[model samples]
Target: MRTVAEVARMIDHSLLRPELTTGDIETGCALAARYRVASVCVRPADVPLAATALAGTGVLVGTVVGFPHGGNATAVKEAETRLAIEQGATEIDMVLNIGRLRSGQLDDVEADIRAVVTAAASAPVKVILENAYLTDEQKIAGCRAAERAGTRFVKTSTGFADGGATMADLRLMRATVSDTVEVKAAGGVRSLDTLLAMADLGVTRFGATVTDRILDDLDHRLRDRDGWTAA
Candidate 1:
């Protein structure tokens, strides 16, 4: 049975909404600290704030590059990585250029990811696949590109897309990549049961804004002696 903290550790509290204020990022950081989540995934500009708020709290600071859409030039993405890292980001979740991949530009896609991976250097770089728009072949291709670029993780969804992570995609992504490349599922993981189900599919990390709700539900279920079964 997975305990509350066990599930909490897999979450990267998402604070990427463009409308959020600095106050919101600070509050989100506090929640991450309270739950001891894996990280606080924030906007690139908010990296410094999150880093300061999470300092010494053991929660790693993470930020996005190329954002919801992966249309940025390779050089720009690399520069974003450098700046975010200087601002205290330890992990970068970069979006893969979906258009390039769909256009059969696998080499370009791989190079785009490599640029960020190189800039991040020692920091872990997660390539966001934005699976909502890809075919199974396309998703498999995306996984191969990420692996070739040495991405630490291949993530599903940007949450801005038409759909989010699904069981089938999770299975495919986990199967295509070697064990060295971890998988992360973002979006629509709003409950304890859903999270556990994805974890069962070999996902090692998640991006979420509903951290408190899921953990609170898990805590309540445990208090009721209901075991790990979702309430």
Candidate 2:
């Protein structure tokens, strides 16, 4: 069984809400640092602030590329990736072109992902498939495209989508990608149960807003050895 700290290290505490002020980002970064979470995934503009805030905290700084909508031109996504990395971001989760994938523009989609991966340089790039809008075949193809583009992970959902990560989708994504490409699930993973469930399905990372709540609950459960369900 995984320890609370182990699970905590897998969380990429999401600070991507649109209305979040600088104060909110500061607070979120502090919380993530306190918990020793893997990274604080912030917005493009918040990268510098997050990096500065987490400078001595041993936590990584991450950001999104093309964000909630994956329709940005390939050049734009590449620019976003390069700038974020320059701003101190090391983990990048970029949105996939759902429209292009659905339209069977496999070459375009692969090219898009490759652009971001190239711009990411040595940093890892995670491709968000927004599984809510895709069929199983599209998901597989998306995974394959991400792998071909040399991305590190195939992510599910942007939270702005109609739905978030589901076990079935995560399992399928894991099955589709090679061992070199891992999986990340975002949006709706609010509790320890949900996180561990996805972990069991081969998900290695999560974008979460409730980092403290989940980690605290895990700590309490471990201390008491209680049958907590993370509800």
Candidate 3:
């Protein structure tokens, strides 16, 4: 197994707080830099600033489209996706319309994701199912919808919902999505054990606010272990 520090680099260091200021995003970017994280997931309004701040760094810029609540108008979400990409965002995470999907309005749900996928173009897109609000059947359906929409990833949650990602949910999602599509287990993903466990379950990416802590734990262990082999 890889050390926690090794896995921390796959995390999209997230800051989705509504009240977070530019300074807070700057701090978040600095932390990502220190940890050599994969990317910094921030709000749309902060995307340009983050892109600029992270300039010349390997960390990519990411943002949410429909956000915690996937109830936004489809056109609105598409516009947001387009604008974010134009602003230099390397990736987009879009929330599925939970109500529509639950009601079995699969067309609307599929179209919603398709629009964003079209707008995102070459940039990878992650569809957030907010699985805590979904049943097993709905989760399966959402994964199918994401596949039909050509999304690059199927994410488990927004973390703003009552619950976040779970081992059961991640395993289910992994089973549903094709080998080509990736799974991102987000929300409630903290600590080295959970991170490594999820990675072993086929999750190549993670979204979390505990990124720094995980990296710190990994770094401390790395120093003690002499090399990553012992970790």
Candidate 4:
């Protein structure tokens, strides 16, 4: 039985839609604050607004660097990271160059991630694998590249992909990376049961647009006390 607060703590409380208005970002930040979520993941352009909205609260302000796709140039990603840091983003979730990773250009992939990590300075960088596109071998290679690049976390997907995080991918990532680095399971995480299952698999963070729904589910279950118990 995952509690509302427990589920909140694991969520990134995502608001990455390009069509999301400024008011939507504000609302998302407010929800994150009210729930005490781990972070609010918004688009790079909205980082400053989210940061301002989340001020005085301990919740982190996270933004994507390479965004939904990792096809951008390395210099672009670096500049994006630097700009995001300047805009008060505390965490950067960067998309790795899937093309490069799949081409077996491991050094290029590592360099791309390293550039962002360097630009981010003291802020943590999470390299998104966009797992739905990769083979198991490619996934392992991506994790290894991110690990070598000093990424703080290796994330599962962008949610734009056809699929999202899976238990198989989660376990593979956990086994591949250093225990010191974190695993953020993003994409399609919807219910309390799935969240708890991922947590059990060593995922510390989750990115989801339906975070409030998950919280609501937890609340409803706890209030009923008929089908579930406290976590």
Candidate 5:
């Protein structure tokens, strides 16, 4: 069984709901820090606030570019990536151009992702394929494009789509990308079992909104299994 700390580090505590307030971001950041999660995936506008709250906590600040829809122009997404990093975001999750990908414009898709990756420089970039809208073939192509474009991760969803990550999708993504490019499963990853199942299939990162619940469950289970007490 994975330890609570190990599970916590895999999560990118999601705070990207469109209606979230500044106070919500602060609260979310505190939760992420307490849990020592990998990062806080916040909205673009909230990057600075999240950065301030998570400073010295060792939790990275991540923001979305192009967001739920990957329709933004390449230039716009590139600008968004630069500005977010400038404002203290240490990681970026950018939505890929789903329309172009579906239209079989693979080259365009590669260029679009490369633009953001270039702007991100040293910071890692996770390309959100939003798998809910893609076919398996398209998913494979997106994974390949992301890898070729030099992205650090190829993500499954943005959690706002009609569907979320599925086992079939995760398997396909894992098979499509080399180990150099990691896979992130987002959306509907709200339980320990679900996360573990995905991890079994080679998923390395998760985008989750229920960080507390997942980590708390793991902690309880570990304590019960080992007869250990919390310090």
Candidate 6:
């Protein structure tokens, strides 16, 4: 069984909802610090707030580029990435051009991701495929483009799509990317079992809003099963 910290590190506590206020970002940062989760994937405008709040807490600050819709021009996405990094985003979750991928324009798709990867400099980039809009062939192509562009991870969904991460999609993504490129599952990862199941499929990161519930349940289970206590 994974320890509380291990499970915590797997989560990228989500704070991207448009309606979230500054207070919500602060509260979310506090929770992330308390649990020592991997990072907080915040909205682009909230990067500075999250960065300041999480500073010295060891939790990374991540922001999205291109967001729910991946129709932003490549240069615009690149500019967004650069500005986000400037605003203290240590990690970037960028949405790939879903339409381009679906249209079979693999080269343009690859270039779009590469631009963000370039602008991110040293920051790790996770390319969101928004798999809900993609067929298996498009997903595979997206994964290949992300890999070829030197992204650090390929993610499923932005949580705004109709479908979230499914086992079928996770399996396909895991199989598509090489070992050097990790997989991230977003959407519908509200339970410990779901997170564990995705981890079993080689997912190393998750985006979730239910960070507290998931970690609390894991802590309880570990204590009951092994007399384990959180540090």
lDDT measured at residue 111 in model 6 versus the true structure, 0 to 100? 96
Error of 2 at 21 (Å): 0.5
Q: Taking the candidates one at a time, how many backbone clashes does each contain?
A: 0, 0, 0, 0, 0, 0
**lDDT by residue for model 3 (1-231), tens:** 476556866799998889998899999999888777889999999999999989988899999999889999999999999999999999999999999999999999999999999999999999999998999999999999999999999999988989998999999999999999999989999887788889999999999898878877777777777855443
Relative to the true structure, candidate 3 reaches a TM of 0.95
| Global Cα lDDT for candidate 2 | 0.93
Candidate 1 lands at a TM-score of 0.97
Superposed model 2: Cα runs more than 4 Å off: 226-231
C-alpha lDDT (0 to 100) for residue 133 of candidate 6:
85
Per-residue alpha-carbon lDDT of candidate 6 for residues 86-183, written as tens digits (9 for 90 to 100): 99999999999988899999999999999999999999999999998888989999999999999999999999988999999999999999999999
Q: Write the per-residue lDDT of candidate 2 for residues 87-187, one digit (tens) a residue.
A: 89999999989999999999999999999999999999999999989999999999999999999999998989889999999999999888998899998
Q: Which residue segments of model 4 deviate by more than 4 Å?
A: 226-231
Give me the overall lDDT of model 6.
0.95
Clashing pairs in 6: none
Off by over 4 Å in 5: 229-231
Residue 199 of model 1: what lDDT?
A: 96
Which run of 10 residues does model 6 get worst, by summed lDDT? 222-231
TM-score of candidate 6 to 2 decimals: 0.97
How does each model score on TM-score?
A: 0.97, 0.96, 0.95, 0.94, 0.98, 0.97
> All models: lDDT?
0.95, 0.93, 0.91, 0.92, 0.95, 0.95
How much is 172 displaced in model 5, in angstroms? 0.5
Ranked candidates, highest TM-score first: 5, 6, 1, 2, 3, 4
Candidate 4 residue 65 Cα shift, in angstroms, is 0.6
